[model samples]
Target: MTIRMIGRHIREGLKNMWRNGWMSFASVSAVAITLLILGAAMVVALNAEQLSTYVTGELEINVYLNQQVTDAQGQQVAREIDQLSGVKSVQYISKEEGFKRLKKMVGTQYASFMESVNSGNTLPVQLVVKAANPRETTKVAAEILSVPSVHNIQDGENVLGKLFSFLNAVRDVGLAFVIALIITAMFLISNTIRLAIFSRRREIEIMKLVGATNWFIRWPFVWEGILIGVLGAAIPFAIIAYGYQFLYHYSGGAFVALSFPLMKAGLVAHKIGGILFGIGIIIGLWGGIMSVRRFLRI
Candidate 1:
């Protein structure tokens, strides 16, 4: 714990790397590979979380009026739905707007179908209602459906629920994968460091014989493990960051224009990077402690 003792342990650790060169290299290499795998998974998990949050924030409920309702009646229905509780705002799309959208979707061939569909039968006007919470969507949807001349309601809740479920599955898988890798890394790294320590067994026994405390022997190896993990994560983190940036520019903007904030790829990547670094340090420390414990027991 004193400066002189700390300095001595650090010097000993550095020298041991050369003294037991192959064994030391094995330990460092194991730490590097383990951190790399963990960092990659961390990046993916973070991005998935960000994307899921974005999707939840932008969820909306769609209210469709009855075809039997006249244009004026549909307008009245929209006005009433807009005044309902938990409705952030109501956007009304008249039958004409619906036809225009249908025209855009179906092209000239469907123009005849549109005329037929909208002629005597009212094209149920669409009411897009925003809710403060996704759960509020169902209640708000029920109220909208209760309005006179509002025949049916099709809120995107089913689709959004499925999406969130998928996202949760992704998160769970990522977490499990990361945890498994970290455990493996800890095992391998500890074994590698143990090998290094075993190579210096006689020297450690001599140190113990000479009154060197256990802490004196432990700190240096822990520092070495920390160093190896931090170094290993650097390159993989950089590569993942670049890949995220490229995807953001190439696909994210186009994807997000259609969906809400679900596709902010850049922010997602940034968040992932931060998480990777934290995991790397913890795994590195774990490798160090496990490695030293085996030797300390001797």
Candidate 2:
């Protein structure tokens, strides 16, 4: 369509909103609530994944060697672990080193008693094992268990597994909630546009009876919905933008230190802003078309 035609559609759309002030206000309110929920959900989903990843990165396995395994046997076992597909690194700690570490951990009060307990009998030579992927740690440990000298593994990586499941559930549930709310927002917007169409029913009928195509009649209401959606999105964008920045600077970015960081404010605003506007535009366009559908049939 020509620029002039598009301009006219925009003008007529804005004029309809001005004439139907209360309904327009209600539509904007509905969309604003929907987008606000959307913004909150986005933040949660992003952070849940971040937390999961942080935990995964920190996860590691401690592989204990058989006390009878010779130094040569321990060296071979370390090589085997290093060769494992998912192994990130292998660090060998001899019985002497382990006993020293034990004393350091148990502290000076217990140091005298720990010295009498022979290092070879009390402490097993072991490998500190890290996996390339956190999720594969269990598998890596199991494979290591099959080797000749690997005696045991500790912690079983239970925490990392539970964390992955919980975070995934959070993301999935949030997605479903956002989708349902968006559909609800569309209906709210469409209903408001329907009222606007009802007020102009006679004009629509006359346009239909004449040579005006469906596209021509649909344009104004479509623009009306688009305008409503855009306006609805604006409030939430401001709230999310400033609120995220405050949390980033004032609250130290994330709930956890080091491994976990809330996405930066500039990045959050950029991403969330685009998403909010896109949802707004789609809801408006669809609501407008749906509202105008019955009027076009006349």
Candidate 3:
């Protein structure tokens, strides 16, 4: 509690670590390895979720108009669809524009084939609808289908459904893996701390015989555990920060082919640093408490 008591605990903790050099190294190594795995997993999970979101946000609904629909009727339909709930924006593409776009897509080799069609630009006028919320694309598409000039709709419902399902599965699996790793890490750390304290059992008994309070005897080992945790987490934190920065820069801002963008390196590092530090402290304290309690049998 007092400064002097804190200083004594820290000094004793350092002495204990030195006294059992091999065991101390093992404990620190265990902590570092566990935290490193956790940090890497966090990075992957965060980026995967972001990529899923980016792809979802690009989804759109295409409403094709009937061949006989007049320009005025098409404009009216666009106005009505834009007013619908969950609709973000609606742009009308005339039949002529659609034909030009098709021609551009087919390239020079197929230009003659498109020109041979005798139906005189049979491509239907279309209203491209963007949803304010990606999850509501189906709902917005349904509303657009009810509009007067809308002959049909292509909302990619099946593809979006599969995408959402895959993302959810990834999230669930990542969560489960993290939980398993945490449990395993705690178990290993607790056992290592117990072994470290077991070697000092005689000293603890001697302190008790000399009328030292249990709190006084326990503080040093607790500090030792905390130190191990902090030391283990430190290297992983540095590695993650530097590695992520390199990766972000190397990938150039966005992976255009995948339609995914990495979060700013500084922001990701800051958040992950806080998380690793907090977890380190908690695991250290927990291992200490468990080890001390088992040894003291109190």
| Candidate maximizing lDDT | 2
Badly placed stretches (over 4 Å) of model 3 are 19-22, 48-57, 67-73, 83-86, 108-119, 132-135
**Which residue pairs in candidate 1 collide?**
66-151
Each candidate's TM vs. the true structure?
0.81, 0.78, 0.84
lDDT of 3 by residue, 1-298 (tens): 8999999998988887887788778777777777887888778767767766776788889899998886777888888888888899998898778888888988899877988872677777888999999888888888888877689999987976787788678767866776676666666667666776777888888988999998998898788888878987898899998998998898896765774788788887887898888888788778878888887664
Q: For model 3, which pairs clash?
A: none
Better of 1 and 2 by TM-score: 1
| Candidate 2 deviant stretches above 4 angstroms | 66-80, 83-86, 93-126, 132-135, 202-216, 257-259, 296-298
Over the stretch 46-111, how does candidate 2's per-residue lDDT look in tens digits? Answer: 677766777677777898988888667788889988998888999998777887787888999977
lDDT of 3 at 242: 95
Instruction: Quote model 2's TM-score.
Output: 0.78
Q: If the candidates were sorted by their TM-score against the true structure, best first, what order would they fall in? A: 3, 1, 2
Instruction: Report, for every candidate in turn, its global Cα lDDT versus the true structure.
Output: 0.69, 0.83, 0.81
Top candidate on TM-score is: 3
List the candidate 1 regions with Cα displacement exceeding 4 Å: 1-8, 14-41, 108-122, 132-134, 252-270
Tens digits of per-residue lDDT, candidate 1, 133-189, equal: 766778888877777777677787787778778867876786677677677766765
